[model samples]
Target: MEPGTHDLRVLIGRQRLCDVLFEGLGAFMLLMSLFILAALFINLAIEGLARLQPDFFLDFPSRRAGQAGILSAWVGSVLVMLVTAAAALPVGVAAGIWLEEYAPKNWLTDVVEINVTNLAGVPSIIYGLLALGLLVHQFRLGESILTAGLTLGMMILPVVIVSTREAIRAVPQTIREAAYGLGASRWRVTRDHVLPYSVAGILTGVIIGLSRAIGETAPIITIGALTFIAFLPPAPVSAVPPFINFEWLSSPFTVLPIQMFNWISRPDPAFQSNAAAAGLVLVILTLFMNAMAIWLRYRARKRIKW
Candidate 1:
């Protein structure tokens, strides 16, 4: 072969080698992830399988690991998530809509956008400290369910807003123009044309944000949420005519992660088992939320055409 032909062959060989190297690297990374997850599941199962009794879900925290349960922890988690969704979802989505659809393309808008992105990347512990100083101290919310909700809501707000903006941006400009041409105002266009196409993505983002919030231990801990609680919050339902109670918002709370942390820190092997059980429950809850979000996204994609 000529010199140039030999060089070309060498180049082809190097290209093939690079492709094989990258393929192997990708496979190795994937395998590593799977192996780690498998190890975690196996360890948790070994520790917690026998402890997954019905009473484990019904009872409250106790000194004895066998008597301790996740009742308050899980309930508090649910209540906090409810408050978080109620607080963050509307504001985040509205902010996103304003920024994407209505905000003037000016320096102020650009600065605000930059800040929001920065907030999303801020350390979770920093948010905790901020919540500790601002909400717990300044506002006097105390270490209650409301405080936890507010802290997590603020932490996840940027995630929701960014996701919502991206979803809205994904709705084609032509769609907005067509709506405007049909005599629709900006509000009407967003309400009818933009939102319908983007609700799935918005919900997906919201749920993912909530999942992150659910797993958060730092901020809530920073705000001084109790790690062990033997009692439940006041019931939302009442026998009287005004059948709802909001008093529980002020009650002390312990989230799943906090409770799990408490157990995991104990010297007893039984407490370690209990912690694994709690962790497993939390993982299941997070997975369930994600699955619902995925289903919503799938349905939205199938139903909404360009």
Candidate 2:
């Protein structure tokens, strides 16, 4: 063989060696990370398993650590999350579609997109401050469920928007071209073809953003969410005509993270246990949301033909 051929073979061999070394290093890092996660979870379960009773979900928080429960906290978390989802879903999805599909390719849209992308990485506290000024004071929404929901919704809005744009962008250009060729209106094509193909991705992003929001303590606390609340919001259903109550939107609230924070901040060991239990629950919830996202993506990929 010629010298050039020999040199080429030596370069290929060196590249494979580098690949093997990196592969081993990556595997080691992965295993070490998993080991740390498992250890932390095991410790939490050991500390809190006995305290994680059914009553933990049913009873109101109390002065006595053993008697205290997360009834109001969990309820508020669910309601706030519901409002967050409701507030963010349509607006984020719509903004994403318009930007990606119809926005004029000009300086203004470019600047808007840049700001949105940058907003996604801004600290949660900045959003909290903004919400406190705009939602709490300027708008007089107060420190209520609606305020908290909208605050968290706005915090995650950029994430949803960015994810949605990416998902829509992922739809093959051929699909959009074919639809246009067949005389489908832009709205119709987006509604029928692009949306269906991208729904899974959009949902995964939304859920992941929600999971991040659910654990946030700063924004909620900054917005004046109560750390301890013994009462539930008014029933969302009423016996009166029209049957649905809107008053709950303005009701004061708490959440699992705040409850955990309250418990952990106390000096009592029993309160520590309670905090551990709440932490366990919070972790489980975050994990479940993430798992749902993974499942949605997997199912969508499996169902897609091309």
Candidate 3:
């Protein structure tokens, strides 16, 4: 063999060896992440499995740790999430659509974009403090579910807005042009063609934002949500002619994260087990939200070809 050919072969062999080493390193990193998650879940299951009774879902927290359940905590979480979604979704989607579709390419628009991107990176604790001043103190909403929900909505708004813009931008420009060629109004084109195709991506963002909001402790705590809440919110139905009651929005509330935090802070072993069980429940709830997002994305992909 020629000397040049042998040197080239040697170089090629060295490159292949480096590639294999990098691949092995990547695999090792992934496995390490999975191992950590598995170990955490296993520990939680062992501590909480015995406490997973029907009453665990039905009863409210009590002075006795054994008798305490997550009824009020979970219910509060659901109500607060509903309010957060209501406050965040329409505004985020609208802001995203306008910015992507209508905003002129100007310095003002660039500034708005920069601020929103910056907001997404801001710490959750800062959001909490902001809410403490704006919603709780200035607005006098007090320490209530509504206050907590609105605080969280503000915290997650950037996530939704950025996600919505990305989803809308992902739609091919050809689709919009074709619709315009067909004499469709811009709104009609956006409503019928662009949004339909991008629903999956938008929903994925919303679900991820909601999952984070549901697990948050700082904003809610800063807004003065209690660690222990035993009473349920007022029924949605009322005997009065108005029929629907919304007074519960002003009621005191506690969510699973706050409850778990409370339990985990206790000195007793039983409370530690309670905290583990609550943590497990919160994880299950977050997972369920993500699964629904995945299912929605799958359905959207099947229904829309583009």
Candidate 4:
């Protein structure tokens, strides 16, 4: 064999060995991370699994640990998230669309973009303070469910906006060009081509933003979300008149995180168990939301021809 052929085979063998080593390292790191997460979750489950009964979700918080539940907290969380999604989704998606498609590229737009990117990284506590000053004090929003929803909405607005822009940017420019070449208007092109292709990405961002928002206690607490509430807000659906009531929006509320916080602060071991139980539920709820998003994204992607 030629000396050069021997050297080439040795180089190939060494490169292959390096590739195997790198692959092994990556697999080890991934498994280690998964193991840590699983261990923590398992610990939480062990601490709280006994508390996971029907009454635990249906009853109210009580001084007696055995009688306590998270009914009001979970209800408030659902309502707040509804408002948050309503308040953030349209506004965030619209702003992203306007910025990317309609708005002129200018210094004003540049400033807005830069601020938005920066705001995504801003501490949640700062948003809490801002809401306290602006929504609670200035607007007299009164630290009700509306105020908390708006606060959390604003907190995740940057995430939604950034994710939206990134998603829209991911769409191939060729799609837009083809539509334009077919004489479709800009709006039509965006609606018919860009948005359809980007819906999966947009939805992923929206759900991911919501997942982050669900666990946030600082901003909602700062905005005066109650730590303890025995009563729920007015029913969102009524039998009379318009059939939908908005009174809940103005009603004071508490969420799972604050409920857990309240419990954890108590000296009683039972309360600590309650807190652990609530935390476990919160983690599960978040995971479920993410799983739904992933499923929807998969289905959406599967429908596309490209």
Q: State the lDDT of candidate 1 residue by residue for 265-289, as single tens digits.
A: 8899989999999988887788899
lDDT of each: 0.91, 0.91, 0.89, 0.89
Best by TM-score: 1
For model 2, residues 152-223, the per-residue Cα lDDT tens digits are 898889988988998898899999999999999999999999998999889998999899889988999898
lDDT of 3 by residue, 36-97 (tens): 98888888889997898999989899879899999999899999999999999998988899
Candidate 4 on 1-306: residue-level lDDT in tens? 556988999999999999999999999999999999899799889989999999999999999998999999999999999999999998998889888887797998989888888988899999999999999999999989998988899988987887788778878888999999999999999899888778887888899889988989999878877556999999999899899989999998889999999998899898888998999999998898789888877886677655
Each model's backbone clash number:
0, 0, 0, 0
> Could you give me the TM-score of model 1 versus the true structure?
0.93
Better of 2 and 3 by lDDT: 2
TM-score of each: 0.93, 0.91, 0.92, 0.88
Q: lDDT of model 1 at residue 103?
A: 92
